[model samples]
Target: MYPFLRLAKEFYVHRNDPALPLTGTHVSHHLCWPWDLDLWMELNNGRTLTLLDLGRLPLARRVGLIAVMKSQGWGLTMAGVSVRYRRRVRMFDRFHTRSRCIGWDERFIYIEQGMWRGGECCNHALYRAAVTDANGIVTPDRVMRAMGLDVASPPLPGWVSAWIEAEAKRPWPPMAE
Candidate 1:
């Protein structure tokens, strides 16, 4: 069993738009590694807290998020992510992230996530995920069971089909003739 699966109870759901930065403005730089101020605000809650520094919080929170579907027996693996930024964020700012399930198929699940500041949407993103096993292996049936998703049969989305086909044709080396 995953330790995070147990620690998930520590985090409570917070719903409220906290103060954030404006569009085209540069706030505190280097607030965290790998991600700059804007990216941080777009992806995080804008608190001084760092996902990495939070120790068990990250895994717990993520596990909690997954638990929603996992309880339904669905396995999830991040497939693709696309983000759009409309504003910046500064120090001492507070905000909220809203996540919702949009759609799903046998092979994939779709989610829409957003970052809000002061009742305005500063950033939005869509995620494509698939179910996997404890070893990070894709097992459609097992994933569905883990997430508790009910379906008479596996469904395939057109986009997912296209992506899979494209990936299958890609050459091992870019310059390979």
Candidate 2:
């Protein structure tokens, strides 16, 4: 299950939130439901990624990305992601997620997100996302313009830049053993 109801609840909860600048952080709270657990009785890795969406989508809404996409007939898609998990989230445990756009390049936007419990980070993820329309991928410049912003992207953090560089060198379709 994709938790559509929870997403709707989140939208309702933050409907009145102030609009955020391109890089402003949006934070959302969540609980670890029993169904979100794996065999070890902690949050499953895949579920963590799915749960992070609860934060990411709200961030997109707060920043007006969703509205722009809808109006421009553009779709938002994740091109790549890297995640780190450092702590356990047992059933019923409460946590908060923080999400923000780190920066963008000509073709892609980079987002940073983290899950925290009791003021400690439990996991973090970096996402490479794209905006697309009928032709193909839409440039970040056009996306920004649609959102009524004319500013340039802040420089991408070193780690995110490194990841982009490394991904460039990786063989597509991957190599067979």
Candidate 3:
């Protein structure tokens, strides 16, 4: 199993503001395609370390990370994503991306991620993950249990929780809207 704490720490370290400049443009230019792993690979300069790479960072490792977090009695999920790109990453460019747990609530967890190349910000993304099940139903407690964590009523950080609540209220644009 993957170590959740270590992954979480690594993710957190890469979060930043997407509107910032990377190279010459704002990070928004890099997000033209969402599910393109090739673009991600290119961004990393023919190397591996893209979001898909991170997502596939050994399922066992991710499961272990989730297990550790659940053991702490915290709720989390992988819900939705919003990414903005600033510039096109070319071959041989070395970049870094960070993810951070901004907050959470009864239904979702809010994460902020940022990508940088050579000290310039390249991309920024906000992810909203649902605390749900395979059927896509909200069940934070059950999800926690599935990870082998004993449930607790521990208080969450104010900023983290508040961010989730605020994000939950935003109206998501429809696919054809």
Candidate 4:
């Protein structure tokens, strides 16, 4: 289950945080609860993705994205992601999460996030996100303008652009056996 209660706590705790620029990083802390683990006793690969919401939402709040979303009646959605899991995260373990918007293209915004324990990174992920309304996607430039920021998007990094290109070439519907 999604941690809606924890998400609410994050919102309340960060309500007073100052607004951030597009490239600013939002750092937060979290724990791997018993329920977050798999049969093997480490954090489940799927659950790791869900837990990332706790970090990303707070980052959005700090950057004033939530305010814009609310005022414009827009919703955020994760269109895609590429993630790598490294070290194991055991139950009751504490970790620090770092999340930020790297940049955007015509269709989606890109965010980079990592989970770290001690000085080592346990996971890293890049998310392709989109803002939506009753109609469809609201472009990132328009979304930024709603937050009173300029409409210019920083250039996407080479890796991100390559991923976008790769995804473009990938087949959509799977072939029948």
Q: Candidate 2: misplaced stretches above 4 Å?
A: none
lDDT string for model 4 (1-177, tens) is: 888988898788777878778779988888899989999999999999988998899998888888889988999999999999999999999998899999988889999999999999999999999999999999888887798877577888899999999999988886777
> Relative to the unseen true structure, what is the C-alpha lDDT of residue 4 in candidate 4, on a scale of 0 to 100?
95
Per-prediction TM-score: 0.47, 0.98, 0.46, 0.96
lDDT of 2 by residue, 1-177 (tens): 999999999999999999999899999999999999999999999999999999999999999999999998999899999999999999999999999998999999999999999989999999999999999999999999999999898988888999999999999989888
Q: lDDT at 161 for candidate 2?
A: 91
Candidate 3's C-alpha runs over 4 A off are 1-65, 68-77, 141-177
Please provide, for model 1 over 118-159, each residue's C-alpha lDDT reduced to its tens digit, 9 standing for 90 to 100. 777766655566656555645445544543544343344576
TM-score of candidate 1 on Cα atoms, chains taken together: 0.47
TM-score ranking, high to low = 2, 4, 1, 3
Question: Which stretches of candidate 1 lie above 4 Å from their native place?
Answer: 1-76, 134-142, 145-177
Local distance difference test scores for all models: 0.44, 0.95, 0.47, 0.90
lDDT of 1 at 91: 51
Ranked candidates, highest lDDT first: 2, 4, 3, 1
Clashes of each: 16, 0, 17, 0
**In model 4, where do residues sit more than 4 Å from their true spots?**
none
lDDT pick, better of 1 and 2: 2
Most lDDT-accurate candidate: 2
